[model samples]
Target: MNRAALRLSARVREVLEEAARRPDRGDISTTTVIIWVAAVTGAVLIAGTIALVIAKYNGQLNNL
Candidate 1:
């Protein structure tokens, strides 16, 4: 068990070191903004559709 733990720790350390070597610009591009906008619009449309469907069946559901 101790050997397994050491191996795991060594692997984790290597992963951290590799990740630290990369450069990050930390800037958002226009494509990212457009993708976010589309995602939000899709979510809103799906929610609106669900709301409309529930409203349409409200009377029938209450009768049950």
Candidate 2:
């Protein structure tokens, strides 16, 4: 049982060391930025449309 625990600990250390040595691939590209902007714009437009529709209905309800 002790030998097994030592082996597991050694394996975990090796995996962590390998992960630390790997290079980062974390930069965002221009196309990704454009897509994100478009998504945000679309979400804003949808929310505005819903708000306008609710306001129109609410005004009608108040009149009745």
Candidate 3:
């Protein structure tokens, strides 16, 4: 198992829990799940994009 990732995940969950404690924050209350979902989704998409870009350029280098 990846211990570093596990620790990160736990920290993220702890942050969300803290956010949940404040019901008066309009944005958080109205779109709590949406916030985190978007964050995680964006992170994944960004990482994938970086991987894809690197792979594409690396492939081109082989022909030079």
Candidate 4:
């Protein structure tokens, strides 16, 4: 290959290696984000279930 093509291939290899060695950002690791989302979703579902149950039983509780 010519000098220009050789230089470009070397540069691309360097860039790919640098990217592979880079650390992940703290804000958005896949597993961590998924766990947090699942926890929040569970909490919201529980809260909504409790609210619905309370509403359904409101009149019975009021009788006491």
Write down the RMSD of all candidates, one decimal each.
6.6, 6.5, 12.3, 7.4
Tell me the spans in candidate 2 whose CA falls farther than 4 Å from its real position: 1-25, 61-64
Cα lDDT of model 4 by residue, 1-64, tens digit: 6999999999999988877788553446789989999999999999999999999999999999
The better-scoring model by lDDT among 2 and 3 is: 2
Ranking by TM-score: 4, 1, 2, 3
Worst 10 residues of 2 by lDDT: 18-27
Candidate 1 lDDT over 5-60, as tens digits, reads: 99999999988887688645476889999999999999999999999999999999
| 3 Cα displacement, candidate 1 (Å) | 67
Q: For model 1, what is the error of residue 11's alpha carbon versus the real structure, in angstroms, after optimal superposition?
A: 46
Worst 10 residues of 1 by lDDT: 18-27
Per-residue lDDT tens digits of candidate 3, residues 1-64? 6999999999999889988897556564548888989999999999999999989899787889
Return the top candidate by TM-score. Answer: 4
Q: What would the per-residue lDDT of candidate 2 be over residues 1-64, giving only the tens digit for each residue? A: 9999999999999988877888464768889999999999999999999999988899687888
Per-structure clash totals for the candidates:
0, 0, 0, 0
Candidate 4 Cα errors over 4 Å, as ranges:
1-27
List TM-score per model, in order.
Answer: 0.56, 0.51, 0.45, 0.58
Best-performing candidate as measured by lDDT: 1
Question: Can you give the lDDT of residue 39 in candidate 3?
Answer: 96
Off by over 4 Å in 3: 1-30, 59-64
Candidate 2 local lDDT, residue 45: 100
For model 4, what is the C-alpha lDDT against the true structure?
Answer: 0.90
The true-versus-predicted C-alpha distance at residue 60 of model 1, in Å, is 0.8
